[model samples]
Target: MTISIAHLGPPGTYAEQAAVFYANWLVKKTGIEGILCPYPSIAQSLQAVASGQTQLAVVPVENSIEGSVTMTMDTLWQLDSLRIQLALVMPIAHTLISCATSLDKIKTVYSHPQALAQCQQWLEMFLPTVQLIPTNSTTEPLQHLENDITVGAIASSRAAQLYNLPILANGINDYPENCTRFWVVSEGEVEANYRMSSISPSHTSLAFSTPANVPGALLKPLQVFAQLGINLSRIESRPTKRSLGEYLFFVDLETDRSSVQMKSALADLSIHTEILKIFGAYNVLPISKDLI
Candidate 1:
């Protein structure tokens, strides 16, 4: 079946590139293709999947350095319309892409804010005194720099190639290693290459918030995880919306939802917080690089 996988943008961005990676994996493993769709934002993409406009959608959940994306985290809590079919971890590698043929011609740098943060150190090394411009998306700045030799944009090399821009330098992230984990979500049944049974299958994501005034409310769950030997892969807290004094916590742990341990943890978490919700766990295909 053609599974609509919503990514970000028309052709090239980290999300679109990652979608290609996912498509290759799914086709090779499950024989599904021609359904990879790209959207502008997670909300738009996730909405499509939730509305049945698309069969599936890919939403960025976390960056290795940047933690969780607040909107995505919020959706995990508020949007109970869809279930997460897979968790994909794609390593992000930022490049110093430019429209100019030579680095000497680049006087101003343009990129999305997140890309700038990711490559802050590397950009500082070469363009410390240069002007930094923030645009809606990395690809947008690249598109805007079409004929301006004095302006360059940092984006994916795939984007650079698609736009016929040049990559002046690559591996420009401040950290040598940078990656983002995304969720592949869908409304109903979908085909995949792997099953939970292959990798201890049962899993889910929990996003919650508590009264900031309460003491030790946050500590309660961590204490439970420690006591339970639950290996937490990630935890990020974001300030609550429309409330200045509250905070929301997004946590990812590996546990088979069918197991007693998961049930106990969920039950305990429900009692420990003001609110808690689960985004269901489904099968996730292994990222390609993991094979090598």
Candidate 2:
């Protein structure tokens, strides 16, 4: 049987590349065939797995240059049944693509908002007076290209090649260390055998909320982890959307979710928090020169 995997795509998306990489890895490790199912948005891609439309979904969680993808994190919190199975880091190199062979002929720049932000310095230096338009995805700009040499796009080299557009400038991103972190989410809880094989450390993601605004209500659970010597890699608060002053704390622990200390800490933490949702335990695939 073929496994269906969903991702944000229309063909040349970074999410698509990541999904294909994961599918190849899945086949290599387990001898199982996997297929791609492209979704219009990150939330929909993840929803495909939650709604059983696909076996798994790959979506970006964070970028080295742009920080966390808020929509992805919010979707994960809303879709509690989905758990992170594996994580992959892909190098990002944005190129200026267009029908124009020369940068001087370009009049407008188009790309995803995040891409625009990442290449702000480079764009300001080269195409300072051109109009910048934001599209849904990096690959979306390719569809709007016309015969006009005035229009340009900031997308991946794969997108440029796929669309048959000329890459006028290569590696236009402000930072050479740009990379994105993607998570492979699937239905049900995380399984031990599905974890990624990487030299980097493991992480357990979870979300919790307090019962009331009582003193030290939030601190108690954090104290539990600290007292147990569990180091937290990330901790961010998002609005609960139920009421004012109500928020959800998302935490990433640098340890296995199945560890003895983690279980003990969770048991104790439950006493202080109203809700504790454990997303998953997974390993991070570090960025390597070959991964690009």
Who wins the TM-score comparison?
A: 2
Candidate 1, 1-292: lDDT as tens digits: 6567787776777777777777777777667674767677778878887777887777777788776677776765666767776777777777787667777777999887888888887778788778998876678777667677788778876787888877888878888667787777777444444223356554566677764456798898777766776777678787777677678787777776656777778777777777776677655554654431
Cα lDDT computed for each candidate against the true fold? 0.73, 0.87
Question: 1-292 in candidate 2: lDDT tens per residue?
Answer: 5789999988799999888888877787777788999999999999999999998999998889998888888998889998988889899999999888788888899989999999999999999999999988999879778577899999999888888888889999999999998998899964344456453337888999998888888899899999999999888888899988998999989988888889899899889899889988888765464654
Off by over 4 Å in 2: 190-193, 197-201
Question: What TM-score number comes out for model 1?
Answer: 0.89
Cα TM-score per model: 0.89, 0.93
lDDT score for residue 47 of model 2: 90
Query: Which residue pairs clash within candidate 1?
Result: 7-39, 196-201, 202-256
Q: What is the Cα-based lDDT of residue 170 in candidate 2?
A: 95
Worst 10 residues of 2 by lDDT: 192-201
Q: Candidate 2 lDDT (Cα, whole model)? A: 0.87
